[model samples]
Target: MIFAYNKAHVGDVLMILVKNDNGADVTSTRCGNVTKIALKETNEVVAWNIFQASEMLGEISGVGQVVLSDEQIALLNEELAKEGFREVITQEKNSKFVIGFVKELTPHPDSDHLNIAQVEVDNGEMLQIVAGAPNIEQGQLVVVAKVGAMMPNGLVIWDGELRGVKSSGMMCSPRELQLENAPDVRGILVLEEGSATIGEAFSPEKHWHG
Candidate 1:
């Protein structure tokens, strides 16, 4: 689930994206201030538009992909119940960007330039990521943008396939992270030894001028 609010550009509305519709036909049903967007074929809820969101959720401040607290999710559920929608909101608590240690690396079967990597984040949790950075190597500590991350350019990361292989996340470069003074070159950002603990959230502020 992804929640975004941009009062300056989008007004007092909260946009919720629950699932990708995959270009399927969709329908919107509005009840009061809540509009449920669903896939027409299966009637699966895919997104939502909550108008006057601040009045109900209280002071939602963010440009994109705002994380919702459990309390706020409960409030949203209450509103959904009032409108008779059966879906309930759930809080996704994982950090979108984190430090990852590349545990394995191998050549992609179908793509010569792409590589398949097994990155470890969140202690023992592992993610299969396909990367194209020339500098990517096994046993390196790099930044991993997990599924559901909103990049600096407003791109949302999602589970995808690269060259017929499933990829769950991304290996980021400084340029992609929008770090200040990022080198005008191509490669994944490699962290110095002991600079950060594996699985910890990656703070862009620390690397703005690094």
Candidate 2:
């Protein structure tokens, strides 16, 4: 759910939309098979509902299921936070992805570019992961795919080794997660600075085509 201000238009009123008829007066854009909830007074849209699998049009932001562990919901009210607003959503109780912090990074003994990293998936556990991304570094917040996670490309993550270095999980890429405007390069996806909480889930809406 979104708690954003009307970015398209400055308005003092709030528009509540639950059904199609409730938003009849506004111009709804087509996003996949779903309808975007744009405001009548302006182009401000805070959310959408996915109905089918299809390519999206224009620059519509996607929404995913998320649960806030703290009362930092006020961060969503910040002006800068509105631009390309995204969330690390967890779709279910047993989520497959989670926020992780890179605790340490050491060179792989057998590989030139590979690094053996100690990542903190939660407060107590430290996962030893072998990552090949050049951008993987210490003190960065990232999404970690646990074993059994079914990636968007249908690759199920499993505990494995890189150059004989055992890796418990994997750091994710935006392309693997199917996020919009994901960088078409070889690098692990890093969350925005200070945007993620340790151990928070990272399961975005799979049906989002935006």
The model with the greatest TM-score is 1
> In model 1, which runs have C-alpha deviations exceeding 4 angstroms?
206-209
Measured by lDDT, the strongest candidate is 1
Alpha carbon lDDT of each predicted model: 0.89, 0.60
lDDT per residue (tens digit) for residues 1-210 in model 1: 889889999899999988767688999999999999999988999899999998998988567879877778889999999999989888678788999999999999988899999999986999999999999989999999998788878788888888789999899999998888899899999988788889998987753345
Candidate 1 residue pairs in backbone clash: none
TM-score for each predicted model, relative to the true structure: 0.92, 0.53
Error of 1 at 30 (Å): 1.2
The clash count for each model shown is: 0, 1
| Residue-wise C-alpha lDDT for candidate 2, range 1-210, written one tens digit per residue | 321123245322122222223334566655334445656776565344333111211222322222333222233223113433342212233566888899999999998989999999887689999998989989998899876565665455667778788888889888878888777998887877677787888845522223
Q: Let me know the TM-score candidate 1 reaches against the reference structure.
A: 0.92
The TM-score measured for candidate 2 stands at: 0.53
